[model samples]
Target: MVDGESEAADIVEHYELDYDESGRITRGYQQLELVRTREIVGRHLPPGPLQVLDVGGGTGAHARWLAEAGHQVLLVDLVPRHVQAARALAEEGLSVRAELGDARQLDIADESFDAVLLLGPLYHLTDRGDRVRALREAGRVAKPGCLVFAAAISRFASLFDGLARGFLFDPAFRSIVERDLAEGQHRNPDRHPGWFTTAYLHHPDELMSEAAEARLRTVEIVGVEGLCAWLPQLAEQWEDPERREVILESIRAVESEACLRALSPHLLLIARRPG
Candidate 1:
């Protein structure tokens, strides 16, 4: 309904989020999120020739990974450009299909896939009702078993994140912060044609509460990156081997604590349809 996915949507779309040259998607707080997600969905299922609906999955990163690993993957995004980009990646024969679609209205049959991944949509949708609708749609297309979602937390974590990693921000983000503080919530200027995406910070409780409404039971909730995201400068410094490994262990250790979870840059939750 709204243009672009939301603020969160723009963040993912605008950035190059794939694993770096080192072959990892995240570190520190996010380690647990990725670890737990892969563990639950990875171990529980039979070899994934399984059907997977990767909603709001930009650029088919996860879709390509899963598809190449032997699952049938469908990656959808709201932006036409995203679809084209993913399609280009799929041309290499990864058993992945990319389509342009909205998360609030998924054109999928009931119980169609073994898993549904809503990792991006929740961040952009600030309204509780709208987010719940997206969750309901995710539940609609998924069979009763495993589904996972990810969201970015609210700015309250900004204090920790700003301190831990140093929140060197994009010039675009300043306006967003001003609008959010003043108007309760606001969108940044349009980034591209018909694409009005920006960040929408979230309360962790809101995420859990919304999932509850959709009848999706919470399994595991973790952050994508805790203090590490704040330290983009340090992250760049980790180009060497020793520093990277040290960081890997250091961040992985704290990924589970309640305090660390609260301040994570992106929050990831793995939920399932109740039996």
Candidate 2:
């Protein structure tokens, strides 16, 4: 754990974080996440022979694609298990490598990478100082004009999820949701913390402000899986190409709409290190 954050590495290992990448892709909403993230990241990344650093990139899901596309990628995460899994990709001859590392104190050289990703680190860091330090480190390692992509769980995500899944009926869980809505902190105190570990949710504006505080120029912040993806029927239609495309088109159309973005479960902030 960092100075103010929880023992996030132990939690990640206990929860087996490696399943998220593969498991999420099976759900329709997560399918939207996969599609949109790749689309947005692809649009901004420079082509070919570039060094990309995936800070807190779990299990090398994004690293694999980036490497396959001819970029050299190095993924660092706190969980040793995730590092091992990511290293398996490197063993298979992809231009990728993974190692155990912390986002708050990166050992890599400054201005060393063409792009840096803080996709999972911010969500777990509850303290403001820790989050800022992580972002600044990302900015420090990135080339002056390069992009940094950071992801955050929306403040009201769990509230909406609880309502959708009927978890609100339980008094204990309802209280938890209320606390989450009030403070944006999600803590699992029980011995069995379930699938989700300790995390800090973020308001859309708050996430952008954090990036600016790190001196990273804000490019754009958009919802990964928009409100429409929450519909119950979306999963059923995933197998139908026409229906899936229509659903994806709808999500992409409103991804940047300010009012609608807060309804998304996850938000992405794309910023650049100032030249």
Per TM-score, the best of the predicted structures is 2
Q: Kindly list the per-residue Cα lDDT of model 2 for residues 1-275, writing each as its tens digit.
A: 24443466544655474344545553544677777788889888887678999998878878888898899999999877778888988788999989888899999999999999888899888888789999999999999999999999999887887777676787767777787899988865553333255788999899988998999999999998887656777677876899888877887898899888879888999999999
lDDT of 1 by residue, 1-275 (tens): 24544544554455434212122344543344454445434654556688998887766657766786789888888766667777876679788888878788888888898888886777667666777888989988888776755555554544444345333154444455555544325454555322134545665666788888988898766665556656656546466667766755666677657666666666766778865
Clashing pairs in 2: none
Collision count for each candidate, in order:
6, 0
**lDDT of each structure?**
0.64, 0.83
**lDDT for model 2, on a 0 to 1 scale?**
0.83
Off by over 4 Å in 1: 1-46, 157-186, 189-197
Query: What lDDT does candidate 1 reach at residue 19?
Result: 19
User: Once model 2 is optimally superposed onto the true structure by TM-score, how far is the C-alpha of residue 128 displaced, in angstroms?
Assistant: 0.8
- TM-score of every candidate relative to the true structure: 0.75, 0.93
